[model samples]
Target: MTSRVLTCLLLSVLCALPALGARPVPAPAADGMAMLQRVDTARVQGSPSTLRTELDAQQAKAPKDPMPRVYRAFLALPSDESFAEFKALAVVYPENPWPHVGMGLVYVRWGMLKDAAAPLETARKAVPGFAPALWADGLRLQAEGKPAEAEARLREALTKLDIPRFRTDLALLLAGRPGAAAEARALLVRSVKDWPEQPEALQVLSRLAREAGDAKAGAEAGALLVALQPHDREAHRRQADAWLAAGDKAQAVKMLERYATLGGAEPAVLSTWVKLAVELDRPEDEAKALVRLAAATPKDPEPLLRLATLAEAKQDVAATEARLDQAAALAPERADIQVRRARLLLKLERYFESMAAYRAALAAPERPVPEAAEEAAQLTRKLHLPASPAKGTVEQIYDRVSLGLVALYLEHLMEKPELKGNLKVRVDLDPTGKATNVVVLYDSLQDVLITHSAHVAFMDAQYPPGSEPQVYQYVFRPPPR
Candidate 1:
């Protein structure tokens, strides 16, 4: 009574298994359940191919057991084959909810949001308190621009499960909210407390602590993370970032060097290292790191541009231009690369080529920040060239952004209650965009000033529709002059 789909899948597996060059062992007796568990354990430990071989060997002995196929699906991480195996297993083992949930995870991993929805929703209906599908649905909703709704779903997920890892994810998503970053900290704090050996939570705690400017806390968290997960890529990176945040470049570099040595450091990580190295004024280190990263990732123009930047910092125009050529060929569509090339062309007094490059960058589709757009506009006007503007603008309604905000200043904050006066803000509206100074700025009119976070809101501020220089002034006055 096997369904046509199930029969077809088995036949496909039969055909493929033969090409795999392994003689099938007859399916084992029910007592062979231990062997199936062995396959599951191996897959969990990150050896899928070994599990596949085990499955091939076992299939000859126990062709009736669908567990090996389910095990295979588990190890196929981030692929559609997992769903195929799950579906086949579902037909053979109709009562199992695990396969359905496994199918949902495959859709989540592959970013097939719409397809993932039905299967996950079905699984949620079947298993009312399943955290995995709930977490997947939460993330999917977040990506679809429904953060508030995502948060509700994530909270529902929280009610269903008391898992540290899923809670950490939910907390991180919450941190994007106005005051909910504290919840993220609390979640990590609780996670580390309960699962002290959990590397990810410890690493996240390190990042959170450093961001909060608590060096002592960050150091403790990082040390714990490194101890628990010595060779983990994220652990090393977080340690490096923690050191940098704590103002210890030497230590940061040591950790970063180790990170770069680790396999699979993403390109963005390398880019951040290059930027920091450049700012630290270590040309040699920057160049070395650039070369290492350039060799590590695929031939992306970003690394080449970083190399050119490092060379430029060393005042080697010839070498810089050579690096620029490498970048230009690979990233013909990257506006930032084109912008960098245009600036280099300008330095070379190659006005025409520089203008062309700048124009090409200007025409590109990436949304430049208000400040960058403003800067680009200025450069174009200065050079008497026509300039194109970015297509979008966001409107903000705060009186002004400021620093040293007390309860009085809280009113000027995003969605905060009442403010007593006109808040003057020190904002630099340049071509990259408006950056409100977060440093302490005293205001005489009110007993206290607005919080530095207000300035952060402003510095991260994007203006609406105009290339005008952003100017902010917060004046705190008494009720009457």
Candidate 2:
């Protein structure tokens, strides 16, 4: 058996035991037993201070009774003082089985299985068919790796007193044995029915259902566990897994949402929830999970980018831009973010900004996108050179074109200082602001770079659409040194 099962058994021994029906006790001992039950109730009520106060009062009232003394010893468990208290009780009440049971339980809890065997046998001898002593001995034998003997003692204890603890302990033991799963499951089912608050039984039942591939049963047990321990993050996670296995993705998402809400920062859980929400076509859920995931991992830009995609799908341009901006800020050098931003700008008809974004993407220090160069070049060809040529007078339009040419000249000169001569260019434009042809009437510079730059600038300039094409000419001059 696993150490978890052993621990459960040991805790059960310390907490409470079934009534000893095979033997009778004196009136004072019965009164002490009644007071012990009250103490057990207080313990279950989850008030340690109150349980301690009640236990002390009971011990004072019946100093000679082994029942109250057993509880007192149990309260001080896993301590040398508790062992001393149980030993003194065994000496004072040699015929009572409880003191001997408490001593053996302490030794078993301490992993001193050899030391536990003697007192457990002594208790069994003091009162034949005593279920508590038998149960403790079964645990000791189980710890000592004697499964057959341990199973026999546990079964005997169940026959003497068929309580929830006995059922759970036997179920735990049988669960590890091949071909005994059905019986173990039945025992745990009955145990949980008798005591719905039994976490150990529910945990075992959930595991058994999962192993048996009974997704519905596993989900039920997991739900019970979550309800019993709402703050347990792992319980919520397991519940989600069970629900997902049962083909109830909506319920699984709810469980995962609860887990995240409860401050569960596990990336795997958040990532799974995000994926499920997307599969379910739940944009809202996806966004919520992404928001939490972004918060959980401050350095990760993936969640923010996903959120941006989701917002864009919903046509929420503002939110899309906001999320993308946040993601870009987080990873300024990400080529993917720059590409996405460029696409968004292109969609918005902000051609210049889009080109700038594409250039940024292409200029990334690492993983520079070579394809963005083609995209930016294509964008420039598609743009209108002068946005509203019809709205400006011819002189105004010529001046704007001349200023644009000067800016390009200065920009290129910074890279090529030898290109100092000016060129006379003739440009023919269609009424729709498209440059159809360009000829360098005279090129004092006679340079390929200047010719290409002038041709590109005139072709990309926007113009007004008219019934016929328009032709214009300008003489370019280099600035004097």
Candidate 3:
């Protein structure tokens, strides 16, 4: 998708919550857990057959040690069939740290992150400074809405984390830290060199390379990842995306096509391939992909929704509307349904309807992801806007937002260079949209920024050329860390 569409979609998804709640659930007994620890006792003592006998003897007695259940979850993972079973164990033994961790593992499997958070947090709280729980909860927090907390958790996790995958996981989350990507990249380099078959390290390296604006490096890392993990669909898909982003559209098509042949046309990959086809305007290729999507998942609405996204991408307003209407009918409660409807309305210049649809999405009954919903609400606000125009049709809005009147305010400063700052100006205007007066309510927190110049600049900002501005106030500080 284009950056605008992606931004709009992200805005809708991210605004779905007030800081994530997901409180702790009831836990299983640790006494029972201790008893069940005997099963591992046999393993520790290097007795395999005796381990089964011990477990059987124990199961015959209590018939319920949470450890057996947790160990079972650990054994059943990634099969895609054990999610419900693991969930049941987690629900039945909520107090047992094992179940929660197992639940978190299940969440990772499905990429439905919020499910993992509460359990992982419970584990962290239960065993403060526990490496496994700390690392897992740190990753979960990163997935939730608090990056700084995630970083702190990860840092704490690293001090105690001695897992085999420690370096890889640390390298991945490290990329999210400001000014840490260089270090992360170096770490990943060493990790991949030592564990050449580790797809995660290569993937992190690839992403870091992309962030550093070195597409060739990204592509090389991506290609290496796919070579190592040919069966891993995500590696293939990321390689394709990296190739596309690196301006090698042809390579992207080839890689994606290869993945499709391997029964690896994930919704995201299919959507991406379709996007490429649309860009190429190769109707045959596009038609093949659409046909493949329909044949593979006739009951899935995602492909149809993707069709609408493609139409929106082309600015085919009527066609996009029709497609979204169809998709919404198929899956009315799907967030994507309302999101698409909003975007279609926005594309049609029906701002009010667009805003309503976005709001409906926010209020929808289905559990909305915190990040996604927050983003949606923000987008709806940005797109619907207020009843005033920042500029007329001819002039750019930014031009008007920063007017010569602001320069007048700067002149009024009558001082040496003051740090530039931002103050959100609310324009309450007359009927004709002229700003009678601009008020500055909150000064910036930074001494450098909240200086005389900032106050003068915001106070002097003019409304649009022919209209009044709305009245608003801003809380400001230096730019984010």
Quantify all predictions' global Cα lDDT against the true fold: 0.62, 0.74, 0.59
| lDDT tens readout by residue for model 1, 1-481 | 2365466567545543333333433222222223433544454345657768876776667665555555566667455456666766555454444566567667677777787687777756655656656767888888778898888887887776665656767777866677776788888887667556555566667777777879868977897777666567776887877777777776677677778877636777777777777778887878778887887775666667777876887799999988887886776666777777777876775544565666667776663323445545554444332122212342232432222233334444434334345545454555555443434344434432233334434544565533454445556532432
Give residue 281's error in model 2 in angstroms. 3.2
lDDT per residue, candidate 3, 1-481, as tens digits?
A: 2455345334423432123344433233334333334433344344546655654565467443445434543544543434444455545444446656666766766677877777777766665655666766776777776777877776775666433245666777777778889988977777666555555677779888988999988898889778876676666777888898889887898788777877884666776777888798776577567656755666777667666666767777776787677766766666657876876675565544565566667776663544546655554334333224444432344344444324433443555344444454444455554445444554443332232322223333344456545433333222333
lDDT of 2 by residue, 103-189 (tens): 898899899888998998998898777778888899999999999999999999888777777788899999989999999999998
lDDT of 3 at 330: 67
True-vs-predicted CA distance for residue 135, candidate 3, Å:
1.7
| Residue-level error in angstroms, candidate 1, position 126 | 2.7
Which sections of candidate 2 miss by over 4 Å?
1-47, 57-66, 227-232, 261-266, 295-300, 313-318, 330-336, 342-355, 358-481
Best by TM-score: 2
Each model's TM-score? 0.41, 0.64, 0.32
Which sequence of candidate numbers ranks them by lDDT, best first?
Answer: 2, 1, 3
Model 3 TM-score (2 dp): 0.32
2 or 3, greater by lDDT: 2
Candidate with the greatest lDDT versus the true structure: 2
